[model samples]
Target: MSEELGMREEPRGRLYRVTHRTVYEYDDDVTSSYGRGFLCPRDFPGQRRIDHELVVDPEPEDSSTGVDAFGNHDLYFHVTQTHRRLVVDAQSTVAVAAEQTSWANWDDWADWEDVRLRLAQEPLVRQYVIDLDPPEITDEVLRWAAPTFAARRPLVEVVAELTHRIYKELRYDPGSTTVATKVSEVLAQRSGVCQDFARLAIACLRGHGLAARYVSGYLLTNPPPGQPKLVGADATHAWAAVCFGEDRWLAFDPTNNQLVSDEYITCAWGRDYADVPPLRGVIYSEAKTSTIGVSVDVAEL
Candidate 1:
């Protein structure tokens, strides 16, 4: 299970309101809809979850809320109403914490070998060692990450270099890949979205026998100097976090070539995206075609 990283809002002095909504429209009516979502934000020691609410339209007949295996807010709902459109809306307020030191300064960080040996002795992290059903780690991934995970280099340093390399090598091309894209395909294509980069980083870390998880969240973005802020233009972001030791992990964004900072709002984390999707479900409908639209907005509060 993941522990809350108590960093708190006092240090960063930043608070934000996030709105995420997903809508589905079908050609025919959907008789039964079942959904399980991880749309609520998680609280950390340094980060505070001010408030969060999830709403399902056509009110679910059977709905429940609970904590997941990874300690994230899990929501399950079943909508028995017959409809052609379905909506899931989530709103949250959060206080983010900032890291005082730069990731480039890794003097006190643990070495790769020592961290690996220590983690190997811990039997509780069985899930991290095992790959997903299809498996993402490959020989190419290990070989690509080999230069960074040299014998005794500081673990943080290795992670930073790996992130930088990915950011430099990969191109961010929207609509180039989908959630089904594999790590191998990403490497060969050299282009992907944030989730792709995050998964690739996770694959690299796992290829070295290190534990890493996928982080889903939002990132504060500013428009160009003269451009006005666009409402409902924000998108969810993804990053990767590597375990340093017990109850401590280091998160880095290969898409941005930097460590996760106060600008990020973590919602949930898991072994992969399948573990924590914003909205996913099954609909028993005779509709042959359906379309989904997502709108997210992150505003300073």
Candidate 2:
């Protein structure tokens, strides 16, 4: 169940197209079930635009799901259960383009200051800013041993090193925390999933006079030996993206202990999960439980 799924797209001239599908099935004979799904968010730079459609079988059914247009992302959710069966399908065609063509320098904070001000005005994003506690950059944490990383020991370097150290100090336990869990709780427990890790990183980065946000998306895995291509499997993932300088936001995945490469498929970016839950909504069902299944396949066109 903990396997890393593979998903890769082959280029066709200057463009690459990717399609993603997800299905959820429930067998628990409960009276109801609830679920949520996310849509194409603005942070997915390579994607041009996205369209979504919902299909529910039978004429009159007691089920409800819709998209939340708050923040810079869109999310949808629903709750209900029928004795017969229930199925939800979401499909999207993502258009890929060349990478960002700009380089940012350290002294460009003036340019990013505007962006920071704008993001801080949003109600959802403002909450993250208010919630973050200033990180205690102690000499002990700063002096942690890492001879290989000694040369890059400026403030930015310290932030990166501390964040990486925090990731290493924490355990990757998916069930240890939920979306509603607080960063303080995760820090205290020293364990959590990708979401928790991402949130912790963002908070820490922002604490150090840097702009960082939560990135919800999929991680493209390396194909096993003899496998020709990569494909995504049963779950969506999350990470963090820190604004290095100016408009430049570089991604870092502490869960996997790696830098963002061509394999990271971005879906959305915001201060935290509340701004971009892959899927969320209101449901009319009196009682409910839910399950999710996702798969991604990438191949040469």
Candidate 3:
């Protein structure tokens, strides 16, 4: 699918009513299915999830909620009843903080190299800061990110420039790539959706020995003047966050070429897309074909 969600929002802050609906249609009936969703917004420094609920059609035989290792809300459910389609609807009321004034103080931070070495000794930050999978460090990624890692450059400044470079170079074509597309491929193709850009950024940062993680969320969108924002027109969005030693992880939206602010609503994050897909499931079916449809609506509340 389509990755879109969020309402018209202001930089100061706003509470939103978010609804995300996903439907899966299979050619043959699916006797059973086990699914997971990372649909709950996280409570962080300036963001708070007030209330949330998830509904599964045909009612699941069993369901429970828990927090993932990365601290995201993870929901698990299984359906035993035979069905040709499955629907998951998630709704939330979230209060997002205004853009932080602290961003302006980034210039006073330690150099990129210092932050890298600091995180290197911190065992807990290893997994996210290091490239362990498809977004492996390649010469190509290193070359692309080299310019941003100049000596003594403030860590935040380096990432901000890198984020700018990616946004300027990559084309956001929905069908150009899939969830399986690797950062190396994205580098060669120079195009992809939010997820692709996010992963690419993660690789680039890790290539330079910085800690970065993929973030999944919703972005408030604006329609052209005189046009109504269509329901489901907005899809889930993705971005990247880089650690600056200590407990700080600054978020960047290479997809939109901006630092994350109140306009962004974070849901979950992990090493990459595979770690936290909005919705994924295993189904037992003879169907040779399956199609997914997603709809999202985010209205100011």
Candidate 4:
């Protein structure tokens, strides 16, 4: 089991209305569908979920909600009836607070290798130690991350340096890589989206025997200057969080080269994206071609 961060009773923050809608169109009828969604927000150090709802079209014959191993809320649903199109609309209202100061003096914290050994003794932290099955770690990744993580450097300092290096070195190309892309490919190409960057960061940390997990959530993005904010201009964002101790973890947005803050909303997190995709399912259909479109709006309320 994973640790549950204790959130304050009342945190200072702003309210946001998040609408995430996914539409799937098939060439032929879909006789059955089964899905697991990690769209609900989790209450943590600086965030709280006020209310949430999910609507599934062609209503599922069997559906239930439960907490996963990583303490993320998940919805399981299955559609037994026939259908050609599927729509999943998930909306949530959350209060996101500003980042709080670290509880422990980071400067006094032990070095990376010591912290790694300590984490190995904690069952909760050990869960995130393995490499992601798809994007397996390579020698190149370890080499790239080794310099920043000197044996005597403070753990947090080492993590910050590594994150900054990745931010500075990698180009943010939207379609440069896919979910199946390997970390070695990313290191070679030097370009990828937020998820790819997050994965790379995770691989780097994990290679050093550190515990790191993938964070999935929404980031508030501003509309272009002089233009009105578009209704669905926002998108679900990804980041990486590393275990500082049994009860403390630090999250960083390698995509934006900053620490996670009020502008970010955490939905769920686990070993990797494979554990907490917003929406993924199996469909029983003869459709040869299918298309998917996702629209997200994270509006301050």
lDDT string, candidate 4, 1-301, tens digits: 1123345364578788888999999999999999998999998778888778888898999988899998999998999989988999998888888764442444336788888888888887777888765546898888888889887778888777777888899988877888878888988999887888888899988888889999999977564368454211367889998887766788887877667767778999998888889899999999999999988888888
Q: Least accurate stretch of 10 residues (summed lDDT) in model 3? A: 1-10
Best by lDDT: 1
lDDT of 2 by residue, 1-301 (tens): 0111135443322222233455544444434445555544232444433333444322223434333443343433333445334444444434344353222323333333344555555544443344433333233322332331333244344435655676688888768998778777777788898888777776665553356778777644444468443212225678877654334555767776655544455667666787777665433433456565555443212
Residue-level lDDT tens digits of model 1 in 150-172: 88888888888999999999998
Task: Write model 3 residue lDDT over 206-244, tens digit each, in one string.
Answer: 887788999998866554478554222389989999987
lDDT of each: 0.82, 0.52, 0.82, 0.82
TM-score of every candidate relative to the true structure: 0.90, 0.62, 0.90, 0.89
- Alpha carbon lDDT of residue 67, candidate 2? 38
RMSD of each: 4.0, 7.8, 4.9, 4.5
Q: What value of lDDT does candidate 3 attain over all alpha carbons? A: 0.82
Candidate 1 clash pair list: 5-45, 5-46, 6-45, 6-46, 7-45, 7-46, 8-46
**Candidate 4 lDDT for residue 249:** 83
* Predicted structure 1, TM vs. truth: 0.90
